[model samples]
Target: MTTYKESGVDIAAGEEAVKKIKNDVKKTFNKNVLLDIGGFGGAFNFPVNEYKKPILVSSVDGVGTKLKIAFLSNVHDTIGQCLVNHCTNDILVLGAKPLFFLDYFATDQLKTDVFQSVVKGLTKACIENDCALIGGETAEMPGFYKKDEYDISGTVVGVLDKKNLLSNRQVQKGDILIGLESTGLHTNGYSLARNVLLNKFKIDDYIEDLGCTVAESLLAIHKSYLQPLLPIINNENLHALSHVTGGGIIANTLRVIDKKNEIFIDWDSWERPPIFKLIQDIGNVPEYDMRESMNLGIGMIMIVDSNNLSFFENHLNSVNQSYKIIGNIK
Candidate 1:
């Protein structure tokens, strides 16, 4: 008789992983969490009384080829955090407060240490965002992944008061575009980054421009915009937000913009990070392609009323966060 273990799925290890992560996951829970791990479905106590009208916003995302960097560096922990933060930022742009998160991890061989690290990262992000790690799945399929390699994806659910939703409907011709700085690549453009660094230039030959090893430059963690933008969510003139991701600044920003208004981005307004410059120099990538494929140092863009530009600028300055008036809606 054939058994499940023969097909490469390790039920035992999965159970062990659940046991291992339970404490770590529980640490992120608050009054809202209703169910613990190892259930058919996870549950949360919705605080419906807290808002006049509450809308639940959700987003799911992975780390993309940034996973390849984690695999290469044998650094599995931060990718999970990156995945959670990336998803959190997506809904934060919509003025949502994250409620809970669920993760999906698949691998051929589930190394206990690596798996724990991944869960720990997820736990950390959930705690930081004031969200609970409700539940998740860990699939061990020997043939689905190469040895020591795994993939991660996460789902985040958040709540927003109906009146507070930043739907981009308020975006108009006079709105000012404020560009928020990114730590580095922040989980996009990695496939192109790897091709440029590994395929074009040898790591041993450090380029004078980047000032770091290619691997170090490529493995920068995808940052969360939560702390920086959360305090400003209630500003009446804040029209919309765009999280710069796979489609880059233009396409992503356009998703939240109306067709009648055109967004004019001043490319020269912000300083391009040296790492991006190095990638461009090595690959000779086209300007349009670069703009479309990468964040180009601006990870998140906030659209605000032109009249409140100075107020927003002063607020951002008080936080000691660098920003620039990248452009305007026309």
Candidate 2:
């Protein structure tokens, strides 16, 4: 008999993976999650009376070609964290706190160790963000995917008070831009990074400038700004927040400005992280292309009232979060 297992889609292995990941996922659940992992659909109970007016905020993102680095390095865990954190920040721009998350994981065949490692990453980030891992889908397709190749994507649902919504309307000329330092590349620019460095250097090759191997520097987790900003999101000093991702400083930061207002970045305001400089030096990448493609140094940027820059700076300093006034809205 030509069975599914014979065809290489191991149902038994898939079940085993679910069994292994169930407990770790449950650890991330809150009182709001109404369904568990094996359901036809994930159910989350909205906290109705919690807000004067509740707005549901949602975002879905994958780690992009950055996964190639994870695959090459055999580091699967951080990839999940990158997906969850990326989704969290997308909704956070609208002043939302993540509620619950759903993930999609697929590969040609299941590797339980890799599967569990990725789940651990998702669970860690979900717990840190105070969101539930309500449900996720894992598929083992025989012909669709090749070798050990796999993909992961996540959907994050967050909620916020409508009265506290943030957008371009809040941004005005003369608002200062404060940039939060990134761990490294985060989840974007790996395509270019891999092209420039992968063939020329081994993943373990050491570079003096980066102080780490190519893999270590590239696998840095995309950060979540939820914790620091949540406490001060509604402060009058704040105008809008930008999560710097696929588009670097210029494109992503410009999203919150009115057409009449323009972005004026003091490129020299903060030192570019060494990995970026290496990428440029090796690839001979143009300055503008580098800015448009990579985070450079800043992972997140906040446009705030110029009058309250010192107050906000004091607040951030109290938390010991490294940030710089990189620009102004002109």
The models' CA-based lDDT, in order, is 0.87, 0.89
lDDT of 1 by residue, 123-228 (tens): 9888988899998888887887988889899999999898899993489898999999987898999888888888876544556687876666776677888887
By lDDT, the best candidate is 2
RMSD of 1: 1.8
How far residue 133's Cα lies from its native spot in candidate 2, in Å, is 0.5
RMSD in Å for all candidates: 1.8, 1.1
> Which pairs clash in model 2?
none
TM-score of each: 0.95, 0.98
What TM-score does prediction 1 earn? 0.95
Candidate 2 Cα lDDT to native: 0.89
Instruction: For residues 1-330, write the lDDT of model 2, one tens digit per residue.
Output: 698899988888888889999999999987888877888889988899999989898999999999898888999889988899999999998889999999999999899999999999999999999999999899988789878989999999999888888862478889999999888889889889999998789998888888989988999899988887888887756998889998898889778778788999999999999999999988999998899899988999999999989988988888888899899999
| Alpha-carbon RMSD, candidate 2 | 1.1
Model 1 CA deviation exceeding 4 Å by range: 1-3, 201-208
The collision pairs in model 1 are: none
Residue 111, candidate 1: C-alpha displacement in angstroms: 1.4
What value of lDDT does candidate 1 attain over all alpha carbons? 0.87
